[model samples]
Target: MEEHEKDLEDVPDMNKKNSIIESGEAMDQLITIDGEERITSHNEFEPVPLTNNLNADELDPETTAKLRGDAIGDTLYSQSFVLKTLLKFADLNWNQQFEEDLCFLWDMTAEKSVCEYLWELSFPSVACGAVAKYTENRFIEIVIGTLANVLCVGCDKTMTKEEIGVIIQELDSDDHLVLIQVMRFISSVAFSSSETPFIDEEAMNRLCFVLNNSINTELLLKTLETTAKLTVDFKLDKNLVNSSLYNAVLTAYCTLLGSAYLELDTKDGILACRYMLENVTNICGYIDRFENATLKLDITENLDGFLQEAIKIIKYLSQEENLLPVTDDTIFFMSAFQYIFINLNVNYSPEIFIAISKILYIVSEIRNEVERLFESTLELECFLISRSTKQRIFKDLKLLSKHKRKTVLDVVLENGPKFHFAFDLKDLKDEVT
Candidate 1:
């Protein structure tokens, strides 16, 4: 009985030893295969494992794709994708969300690679499409505003002649909202660079069409403002004024001036007047440059026609009704006169000189603002004296007196050519006699 008890105890000891060996082997397998150490229930611990793999399903698709694309070092989000998404959202009238995403992508376009991608996708086409598709002003503004921001930041490499042509074609859309945005977009593009490829006669003609149609007061003014910017390029301006569109542009200006003068007391009317005057000043600057070019070519015929247009504009603006209520408070008209005086150098054309003199005479008679007119005239006389070296200003003064009963000539004769030295009143006295 004792021997049997000893065998049983020996059996328990052997079994315990085998169990411990198995447990150690299991722990070794865990460490070598799973890279995780196993812990014992008996107050023993093991080190935590390091992981090499992540469950990608935990991340969103965009993040996953971004990670994958970043691993490969290429852009994960494409301009086309962004543009398509925007187009889809715009079509659905999801404007707020569209703008949010659009601004994000627009910011991305600052990257050269992204800008190149946008060029590849033809961003202008997308912009025009958005403008044409969405009747919502804010949506159109977002799309166009994005484009303008891009251009303003010098992402003009995305600009192409084909894209510009597409924008120009959209200018005829009867939708004023679309038209206004298109003008704003074009203005932004043109102002982006002096070497912009978008300044063409067709573009100018389209702009003139907008001006002539009288789409809206704001639209007309905006179009006029863009036209003024475009005319800053002398070649473009000369081509524009000499094109078939010139008549349309001039008619629009005439209509604007007439309307402005008739509605002078109103705010819109005053803005319209100021815009037209600014446009005229731009045209005058173009004329000055054109004259310089023509002088080199020894040509003067086109200049005469341009001067006649200037006279017509000045005459309309200086009409008795337009100037009769001219008080110290007539800010826009005074500003218009100042702009014309600053921009229109009469030494370029005899007709312009005569027109300026006549306009000054009218202004002096109406407001008795002779001192202001005299200062302007003396400035012109000084420019003429320096350039022509002839005291012909007194002759102009005499002619101006003959046309108007009360003239600025009295003011000029009193000032006596402050900027000229060889001015003898004898010549003036002879011309008067």
Candidate 2:
């Protein structure tokens, strides 16, 4: 085979590198045990460099024009040889190493121009048990981090969104783990300190398509988590956060909540919601973190609007009527709302706090039985006292002793019995203001 074809093979082999190398220290410390597989160079395990062998001068003009095709073909051919060597030398007893190797191979395979490679070279189930054999949490994190870096580099900052879409669609499998890795790449790139790489818009636009097309809930859950994180990292700016991608993620989270509402595995739904909550907090915090006085004023001026939308989302989740037995989703909504409100209050955003108080007061009035309903939910009282504009909460809550309450706090807290009955504990704050 020509040298270019060999290069194509090496690209996809990166996946295997990711899987094996990422399995943590055990796999990291792996040394050839014996046999034909024994390492000849103990100190130098460099990737058999493919670039050095591919001489551009050797390619005819016609072939040189087809850089994409030639590059892919070469990568595939090179990886094929590596796969064989790895499979042969693999130790069945050290399954973790084996699995890591297989996953690494998959990562590499997916990087190739061969769209069909994923289906063709998927790691067999037999290898699964072996790969996870010696799993350690810390090792898993390191391996994942390493794999994320490889993907970021391999994606070649220049890939158009369209190209990325095509590649993702043609990926070997709609595998849950594979999607998780991809999502990890997206999150990392968004937050990476290096200048933001040029990502193919066409490729990113396809995120919703890929997500909607997928059947794996585990993948969906992880995707949701990653999306939530991105929303925070990107501050939910429309330009920074793709609307299609964002909506698709929110839709998925809502879907999970709906499907698992009554199921035993609702924890997945709860966890997904928690992720969303954190993002909201991060976004809100960003407004405060900015040092520019003018920028800060601008953010603060519109803080009420942002908080309102977030409250609406929380309100949806907290709606007891939406589910049976009022799930952890409900509790999570309360907790998240309580936490967010506390932040706004401590930061002394009276405008935003009063806005929230107004909304909760409206809810209290409309949902007559609702007040009695969540009376045992400790989060409600914590939020009220934390932002206590109410005199009682300020006077009673040890934490609120230094804070003062306006008349608005009094008006709201005066009807304390209606709200207090539902709390899980005494107010966490010293004062209502």
Candidate 3:
């Protein structure tokens, strides 16, 4: 019995000693793993085991789409189970290898899906830092080519704004072709009408950074197109929007447009002007918001310059001969000019208002402007009723309605003869009347 009691006493001591030794080994292991000898207050606790926190289920659909899109061009004939499995678990550690593989496959196949997927992942933004570590220039080129094609609307119309937004978010993070792609896409979709992309400050900053740095003319024009679209699509605080970026895009676009001298059978200036107006329709509201210093200091300073630059571009274009590309461009420009002039007038910049009014007179006479800018003249008249700039239109209308001004009357009379050269205008008019 005494021997048994002695053994029990010894057992506890032995167990305690073993525990101490094991604990010491664990501490040593932690120190070695962390590659630090000094234990600091912040480093006292060990991290949760990676395996313990991993989810075993499939990734969310949005996440899966992002992964799949990014994985394109990686496989020649077979899908990678291991890659898919890692993504399924949301294992960020594997993203580097995955992006590398996707870029590789993108080069090998020239497959649209791969490029499309990469666009969706917007690899460089969210994954760019990691991607730069593993990727080379050649691979990035493949992705950029794919993005350029997609930006021009090459695929089936299945692509939606959400998918495009995912790609754009990534593009906004860098100042490369990805950034150009964002500009082109927004310009094409948003500037065509009042439609807007999924853009915000975060996205704009990324795009603006790219615009500020880019030298490519085509890409710069596309960026301008995007800025114009952004201005029109949303009711925004104009000053609050990235003023430097906006001005850069507009200046670049205007410079390129003049350099190209791309002729339009339609009144392209009016369209441009219209797009500009659409972008800044509610300057009063934007200015009112600037009453607060945080907004005014941050947002207003930029606008003063941008608005002046925009006025200069319009003034320059207004003086030049008109060329109409698409019909919308003309009508859009006319409306845009009206908005600019009014904004200037309301803000009491009479010189600018007078200069724009002179351009309106020129636009009314120019053959191209008449053809391109007149199609929706009636609609523009109606649009004026709803706008704060309605007071400015009375100047143009009074000339039209009263003096029988050749510039205005000719526009009203010449409308259908040239427009219906390819169609039966008389029959259509009779049907409408």
Candidate 4:
């Protein structure tokens, strides 16, 4: 036993540090566990320099072009691979690392040269798949931002018919995030590109679906903006009478107005309301032009029905229960009425004149609901109105004298403050006579 104890003590202590070697140098300068005098040179294990990685002189013209193309292609391919992998891994519980990875890949592919390929190769499928499969807001945002960037880069044919179909399909998603991203992408493409992207019938129906059903304020606003952009060039009098697109526009406007009435305090809700009101003014302007041309026998049948719809929407929105009495909120309503009143004239359709007259009377009579709109003044006057307002009213009234519509004259006299009219009843009579 004493001999064994002595042998254990005599054995070299393995834990003791060896002065011949240190950490980080063992592989570089080979050192055995057993003490040795010789050490292997680091140069023997060094990697060979890549002298032939790229040799421009050894390639033909086709090869050279192919290589240049491959550089972009390879980059897009790698990015798409990474994005797909990350998308597969992404879920509700995805962490910041995955987000960073996706953002990095998106940044790498956001360049114009790479963006088209990236969009064509994988983005559409990946985006739809992510929306359908994942509920991660961060992932959706990254996908949306990336797509917006691609659109900004000018994707002429980047989206195939199938891809557009997929986007339309995703619009039906119950997930608000998915719908938002899809609409945002569509809006970006529509506004950014010089050419209008082809939006099919089914897509239009789906947009109407979103408008009628979506409760998300932001989504509703985006839907309205997209629909307006799509139909800006529409010939309302000729091509859009009772058409699906027309009905869609009407439905979207009504739905948005209703929502705005309900949720006035929220920023998006107010914006949606204001946007629809502005659209109404624009449509009225269009109808006014149509009427002027029709008066010269250039066209027949004034679009009185369209004008009535505009006025109805305005009146619907003007209801006391639907409005917010705050100065900022009422400004849009005041602007709408002022715009309609200034545009009304003697030559305008009786329906239009009646519609404007009714709205004016409502504002004047429903003092309790819209009193705050007129600065809480009891008098229905524009005496304190700005010079521009006075000029516009005078111009519209001059035009009204030409048509001699009595209802318009009476409504103006009853509701309009006496001092606001630039010309009086006698002047209107003299002009008519």
Candidate 5:
């Protein structure tokens, strides 16, 4: 067992990607991306003090150095004992000791040196087995979390193709918590670590199912993050070419905004408010909440970015669209264009008004240079109409009222479509410009 928790810098950025904890209080977000102090991601819990609790006897100092543990693992023998104990309890599922060991492993794996040593020791094999064998919600969540921390510490070129197949096979699930962690795992580990991510058809289908149908906001957010990870991190567009996936991204704004019917799973059904920033905020603020801020934040950036990347991939791969300008009528882009134009007339509520802005921003992104589809000038502006909140998350969104670049607000106003305002968006002015 290590005597120290890592400084935040020592912590793996894997868990920090495209997600924010649900910090239950509602505080005003004030931002000026250029001038504002850096907005720390947590309005929620502080980062965990990452350290393992195991204090077992060392296997041997000689053996530890042979396994590249000399610097980080002067105490590698203690880790060996922890690993052996973890295997012993793998099939035991959710026993208290097994859970404790799993948490320790997850904490230990957060350090890259420890993670690499454990990988060489076949901890990843142990983890994948547990991921398949564990049925209880708690164990499945922790083990998947551990596996993600292990595999995704850096670009994961070390993992074999077979290991990814096992995880991809296990992704079909009815539990939101299990699904959420697994989605995070895939996005963080499989996509970043692999030269070419190996997703089986079943896993891809399950992901599409989650994306197209699920109402669970946390799960949906994670699923969207997975799409972003594939497109952004791996640069793998073939994985995202599913028609269902494209349609899901297109109609996602409608589903999340409550502008369309969503299928519910009885196991963890959600009300319409689950996807709304305001509703989720109100509900999650109740006691300790585990809501995903992804829908409000991550999806804000990923959704459009994913689509734009997919389009670029399609053009580059097919070598056909470069000859013809990609347009609203182009076969590949029709899904996104259709979703945007069709939903243009739908009225949106203020707290969730960001949904419309998101979709409209998507349209503006695709139609223009497609330069920064995921630029997210509007992400910080989400769920806010306050003059102060506007300046805090400062991006080009502040100039929307003045119709800068003919921003989203400009399009909505000029179209004369029904829109709900939390406040006068025109007042969300950037004084500097």
Candidate 6:
């Protein structure tokens, strides 16, 4: 990245077709759909001259994938100017004007054609090169954000598997913004490819690197998301990840629960916790898919410590004050501790939700309750008559997730709208980070 100065500096100015932006007159044809103007906001910046251009060798492994289609008609911009600015971003001297230009690049690259054209111009090396250089946070965020937009391709965007590997493996995990963008890049790589382990083995290790090291909530969640995407519902490929990933994910959950600096009682903390828990559950299932006794044993050993940490999180979340309301479930939380009417089998426990999506998703009313029911969850594990005497409420929602959530409309169709139901996961762990 930092070492690619010569490759970047030596770009000897592209041809006039790409070089000249028509500030004087826009492209003659206007883009239209059904004869109506297709309006879009364009970030305008005064065009600047680029000193150099890429050699033929620098544009090797050119990508022809087109996620964007549609001419840049009447847009008043040039592909060459966009490409040159991005390549030279790291080399430019600091100024408000340049920052404004970078912001414009950020907005311009969102168009698929721009992303496609940039990829053709060997964008991977240019983008990854900047990531390698130690730079300011805002620069890292903009460039990486732009690169992530480019990488979010409908077709193969891998310029070179090795170069892609370099981009992921070399990111700065300590920088929260950098880690977040890299996570998006990782996610794009996972989804864009058709293969299991979506990224190359070497690049996959970078996920563990970020998971094991990053404390940023968003980055952790994003990295976990990418990792979850790469996992198969059945068995996992031995090469997808090594033993260290489990250790890293489990430790991340522990760190998250124990983080004194974060306001864990906040809604965002609760959401982060819920996502991480789900991812951890998925990882465990993935590990269980391993037929190799030794590997299974190793992962099971790792889970012991994580289970302890998880218990602590559960305990922390179990308190009455820690839980928030979906406008307060069943018009009462355990009917304000008076009575909880719930169904259970002989083995009903926290682990039961994993087998069936024991999700108790309900709203206090008619429509939203049914909407959340079909949209997010399964059976009602809690349904009962209410008695408003208590000095309290059970708030222990973990028990409600034992059965598939029923549609409130369906239930109301049978039992009427007055029917009361309460739902919550016994430590919700379904969707991944």
Worst lDDT 10-window in candidate 2: 1-10
lDDT of 5 by residue, 1-433 (tens): 0001111112122222222222111111111123332211211112222323332345465654565443444433355655566767545745666656666565655445665677777876776776676566666666676666555444234556776666676576665555666775676553434344476555667777776676555556556656545543223434334435444643443444343333321111122212222111222222112233432233334344333433332233223233234432223232332232222221222323333344445545464553222222232223233323444424534433444424665543444323344444455433423
Q: Kindly report which residue pairs in candidate 5 clash with one another.
A: 23-44, 30-392, 31-391, 31-392, 31-393, 58-77, 59-77, 156-193
lDDT of 2: 0.40
lDDT of 6 by residue, 49-113 (tens): 22223232343343211211222322334665675576565575656666667766655554555
Displacement of the residue 298 alpha carbon in candidate 3, Å: 7.7
Q: Which ten residues in a row have the lowest lDDT in candidate 5?
A: 1-10
Return the top candidate by lDDT: 1
Write candidate 1's Cα lDDT for 60-125 as tens digits.
988787666533113444545565665574456464556566655644443335545555566667
Ranking by lDDT: 1, 4, 6, 5, 2, 3
Evaluated at residue 377, the lDDT of candidate 3 is: 41
Model 4: lDDT to the true structure: 0.46
Off by over 4 Å in 2: 1-146, 149-177, 188-200, 211-215, 235-246, 261-266, 279-433
Candidates sorted by TM-score, best first: 6, 1, 5, 4, 3, 2
Model 4 per-residue lDDT tens digits across residues 1-433: 0000000001111122221111111111111123432221111211111122456677788877766654654332344455454555445456656666665555544334555566656666666666556655456656654655455453445666565555566665565544655665676555543445457655677777776655555566667666655544442232231234334455555555543334544555555556555544444455465554433221123334334544554455444454433345455555654554445421333333333333444455555566555432212223322122333444454544344334444534555564444446444544443
Steric collisions counted per model: 0, 62, 20, 2, 8, 14
TM-score of 2: 0.36
Q: Using lDDT as the measure, name the better of candidate 1 and candidate 6.
A: 1
Q: Ten consecutive residues with minimal summed lDDT in candidate 6?
A: 1-10
Tell me the deviation in Å of residue 381 in model 6: 8.6
Higher lDDT: candidate 1 or 5? 1
Q: Tell me the lDDT of model 5 at 213.
A: 70
Residue 76 lDDT in candidate 5: 37
Against the true structure, candidate 1 has what lDDT? 0.48
How much is the lDDT of residue 106 in candidate 6? 59
